[model samples]
Target: MSILAALTPAPTTNETEWSVGDLAAALRRTLEDAFGHVRLRGEISGYRGQHGSGHAYFSLKDGTARIDAVVWKGTFNRLRQKPKEGLEVVATGRITTFAGKSSYQIVIESLEPAGIGAWMALLEERKRVLAAEGLFAPEAKRPIPYLPGVVGIVTSPTGAVIRDILHRLEDRFPRHVLVWPVRVQGEGAAEEVAAAIRGFNALTPGGPIPRPDLLIVARGGGSIEDLWAFNEEVVVRAAFAGTIPLISAVGHETDTTLIDHVSDRRAPTPTGAAEMAVPVRTDLMAQVDDLARRQGGAILRKLERERTDLRALLRAMPDADAFLAAKRQRLDLAEARLRPALAGNAGAYRARFGQVIERLSRHPPALALARARARLAAIDHRPRTAMVHGLARRADAVAALGRLLGSLGYRAVLARGYALVRDEDGLPLRGVAGLAPGQRLRVEFADGTATVRTEDGGPLAGTEPAPRTPRRAPRRAAKPADPAGAGTGEAAGEAAAGDPARGRRAAKAEGAPEDTPAARQGSLF
Candidate 1:
């Protein structure tokens, strides 16, 4: 008996039994009394997010036990930490039974991690995941430029971190700065910070807005819970994928985050990032001035040394007339040899030019042009001849395929001599599977078809078979053979080619199977 029936009172002349709903209600109240308020700690399981009704449903499970759990819309909204699979949480709520499902559930009013240690375990697991992906690798870091033209800062506009970075930059070599205002903490803060990083990278270099040469993601010091947005996977991944170099100064010198590991450089403070971005302006100017003075002094000393060397060489120089006498003698000697050399070169060049003219005459341009024309005329007719031959070959292939299709046709088999069996519905029957005693069947022979009835037990079994005579009681006929004008070869083929309805009617009248087209197809199958 069902539990309801067991709980219900038996009917009497003046008594009544409990309804199903009333019995279920009683059980629900009994459950509440036994477990009205309780606290459970277990790892969450099967959490696929919230239902449309804003209710969250999942199960709390331990090594060998599992119980259904739910957080109502109001309770879920007020929860400090949302439920997630594999997270061990402490649930404070009341136990209740739902009649609709005939199951028990814990209606959670509050949910949180089991303890501070659980939060650390979760954070460590997330860190390992990010590190395994190579996002925190040393090779992933890019060098920060010594002097950036523009700096893009990602932080809250109203925060002290931004103010510190700006003030520090002004004291050093001041440069262009672009600020991307974003929430440093709270809901969706991680996503906004990531978008800011990507936005800085996406700027067209020479467009209306200049892309940042360096990026700084800074935030004032905060507790671990407040700094969680910087440690989020999205923030870490954005910093890793960004083309611009970045310095992460999320918290104080002692605080660390995932973004710090992935960023190009990690600064101890916001001011420290600014100092790393540029050099001191006054120091740089003084260094440049000193190098300029050294360069000028070296040039003056080289000019004075050259002037002194020229004066010493003048003291050892020869007389002007003596110097010119040898040059005049050399000029007179060169003029005498010049005319003979020019005449000899003229004769050699004339002979070479004559040889070239003779070669040109041997192979004239006109003869070459005539041979090319002849070859061109020979090639022009080949295409038309080839096309005619190709068409003839294709036509032959088509005719051969047509012959192949005809030889393989089923009609060719029917014209040879087989028969087929069909049911009353004109559907082919391979066996006696659905047949019963007194069932009508169609027997199609090569020439025509006939109607017959199953007898005895069925078509395939009986002590004696039905006689080959009409089912009609008023008349009897002889056993059938091939009818007149119908037999094995051409006669049967002609009979089958005639009206099919006429053959079916004749078969019905004689009550015998006839040869038809399909039957003559000698069992090709």
Candidate 2:
């Protein structure tokens, strides 16, 4: 057989031939069937997206070969990591034929970085873009509330993450928690989480679903691929824009995501997030109890101090009846003394008036007698009226003096809150200069007397004496000789003869002259 004839198989007589369109359709089916699902690792190239349609067209190329890739608008929009030129990525989708172009290409359903290095590069790029806009600034972070009345949680409802949070909250401090169910991982996890955050923020404050004061976005520990949802820009931006404070508890302590930086607070686990939401009820109650006890003690102490001061004040007040009786006795004595003086002064004035009248009668001329008669008529009741007015004035003066005396009395001064301080000699101390520390004294109040001692050179209302100092010796004076001038001449002669010391002694003893140095000098001179 010929080589050409052997390569070609004999056609069946009843077989049908495919048209151009039919052959293309059949080829597409064959491609889909052969590679319904595939993963290609290569550097992306020739990447472009239709702005209007939102579809992405790209090429994957390596050292050996290259292939065309297409991502539908919906799938492109849903992708966690977008395809970029020069990025080494893994494209996952089924192979299909484009009938119009007669070409086979990958219809990408999902795309990701090919390895840890590629993934980290993509992550860092995304972080840079967001951080440039101030989304990750420390100043942009909000403070988490110490106690939230309603805490909204964005996590999978069925996972241990939610249960752990709830159990931890109940253990520390029970709070009202509202759970917004979301997928924690996989294809649309990021969208669900971001939407949940927005929904919580959009709620009216007093709506049927009470608005949360705080939010917690959490998921259990997982690999980086599993935790990639939290690293999505959608989730991070949503957390950053949220008005309510958010706590991110995405994975184990070692695992970090973009959302952790944007969130108000970061917790290593869901249970830790719960613990940070509110304080312990028992601890708060204990603090309140301690404050109440301290307040009560302070009030009691103040009342006791006031009571003691009041008792001391009462003891210092004088006896009212005895003080008034003494004043009455003094007033009666003053009245008796005033009456005799007024009578004697009036008698002397009356006799002087009579003598003036007799003198006027002796010098009566014709015109003088007429004027005298008029004067006598005018003076008829003048003496009696004068006597009565004088007596009234004296009485008023006595009453005024009595009032003045009462005001000046020691009892009155004591009643007005003054005390009399007497020294050891029983003499009233009138000035502070007379006081000395360690000296005993009597303090007389209106009602009673107290024995006190000086402290710091001032008398205090206490019994303890201040520390004592050495007493000074008393000065002696020279005695005078008999007033017979016995030693006067001798002392003067001795002083004049230059024996000044002996002369001074003799002069001082005889009292002949002052023993001052100036007098001695004068006698010598």
Query: Compared with the true structure, what per-residue lDDT tens digits does model 2 show for residues 183-255?
Result: 9989989999999999999999999989999999999998788999999988988888889999999999999
lDDT to native, each model: 0.78, 0.80
lDDT of 1 by residue, 282-367 (tens): 98889889888888888888888998899889867977878898998898889888899999999999999999899889988899
lDDT of 2 at 312: 92
Superposed Cα deviation of residue 261, candidate 1 (Å): 1.6
TM-scores for every candidate against the unseen true structure: 0.46, 0.57
Candidate 2 ranges with C-alpha deviation above 4 Å: 1-31, 51-54, 97-104, 307-525
Pairs with steric clashes in candidate 2: 318-446, 318-447
The count of residue-pair clashes in candidate 1 stands at 14
Q: After superposition on all CA atoms, how large is the RMSD of candidate 1?
A: 37.1
Assess candidate 1 and give its TM-score to the true structure.
0.46
Every candidate's CA RMSD = 37.1, 30.3
